[model samples]
Target: MPTENALPQRLTPVLEARFGLDGGAMFGIIPQPLWSRTNPPDDNNRIDMACRCLLLEYPDRNVLIDTGIGTKWSDKERSIYKIDDQDPGMTDSLEARQLEPADIDDVILTHLHFDHVGGASRVDEQGDIVATFPDARHWVQDRNWSWAMNPSERDAGSYRKEDYSFFESNPDAPPLKLIDGISEILPGVEVLPLHGHTFGMQAVKITTDEHTFIYLADLIPTTSHLRAPYVMGYDLQPLETVEEKKEMLYHADRNDWILFFEHDPKQAFARLDFDDDTPRAVPVNPDEISAIG
Candidate 1:
């Protein structure tokens, strides 16, 4: 959002797309009639979920945090979820921000859930597994990476074998760095691990000279789940999610941190403005947020 020469491109971050997908597990204990209004479901009963991906263009590298539900899908799976792939798929969304797939120098995986890591692999020229970020070092939490690599049958759908194998198959795969706690992936890019959404579910935090924003991965998927109790039913440990949110939300509100959501279709980024009773993440347009710092 900066003027042509105001600041370098990479240091000035700009978030991209905000469109919905299908997800019923998000509703959780909320009643169908109430939740349905916020997100109408397809004939298959899957709710319209969002695939909001972030872009951070630094002088040294162009980083993409998560790739939402990609183009590769079986006709059966497509029919079940009512996929609209041939239209504005993930690449098209990235292109809207004047970015091409080849420009991405780093792909950060919050966790290897199908929705989050769907675009990590592409059909290679020889019809084999290959890294989508051919020039970028792919990152994953060691704990979550292992869990995704050897997933239980219950969560098997979350881990696509071909996608995971793509990293393994490429022996020279650009350093698959897996670190713990807070670590810098890029000059101003750091990742923080927050449990509950998945084990070692990490959030991407980018700090500029004057402002900082944390891309709250699956920790707070949609704006609807901003409430501590409004957790995803698919979480392995829902109580842990509640506690993590309780701690983070308070600090997030206090410090005025921008909670850039991954799955909020209508909102690009939101800031938590806490009230006495319930906290609120008032959504801000990309243009408004870009003017900050």
Candidate 2:
């Protein structure tokens, strides 16, 4: 455990929500013998996944990275994804640290995927969709907003209409603030747009005086995906994903950056070690990193 003094007010991981996804779909073209070795599947051939989100506490504002799949799933959808409804979500995670949705000043969505943005809104008493963090200004990449609005046929199925309808339904008071290119949405917190997983998907990079943490959103959902060629089948541009992974891995390895994975079930974050010029993912002790004074 880290001493309170060493903890950074600027970076924290919250809402450790778990779900089950098809093992084959996760690894794409990778043989079961290889991917299954790292993430063993259950009897249903589903592998456990974590929809981990991070909380950024700045002097001026409190920001949430991505909202995990919330409580809006239908019974069938819940069972299909093997979503653990009982698992404490964003609300509980925040309350544990003496906070609430109203306390969050901003929400930065990497993309509008149901899993990543589902928790951003909820059904109200009148059965109307409302912002989950009513007081916060949500940020999203402009290009992604356009892409999600008019999604390609290849990825149209992955997106749920209800998941993002809130953005459209309220034009007068749009909850989202569209960002352009790579910009620091917050002090020391920058968004880098990457293509492949989804158009205009932005990865959050957080830097402090002593350490840096890069939230790898869906670009690299798990540590096992460190391989340059292990691109997700869900990615629109598989080749682009491979190339981006290679470049990102090289930069991360060189800088010794802590790669925070969004869908890794067991490992929250990892470090890379180079062997024969190949960068390999190595799980690091979350406890070891909790304190970085």
After superposition on all CA atoms, what RMSD does each candidate show versus the true structure? Answer: 3.8, 3.8
Q: Which numbered prediction scores highest in TM-score against the true structure?
A: 2
lDDT of 1 by residue, 59-110 (tens): 4457788876665678877666565554456566567667777788888888
lDDT of model 1 at position 178: 85
Off by over 4 Å in 1: 1-24, 93-98, 291-293
lDDT of each: 0.71, 0.81
Clashing pairs in 1: 10-57, 10-58, 20-49, 21-49
Write the residue-wise lDDT of candidate 2 on 144-204 in tens digits: 9889888988888777767777777766333679999999766678899999888999998
Candidate 1: residue 182 Cα off by (Å)? 2.1
lDDT of 1 at 100: 76
Model 1 score (lDDT): 0.71
Q: Could you give me the TM-score of model 2 versus the true structure?
A: 0.92
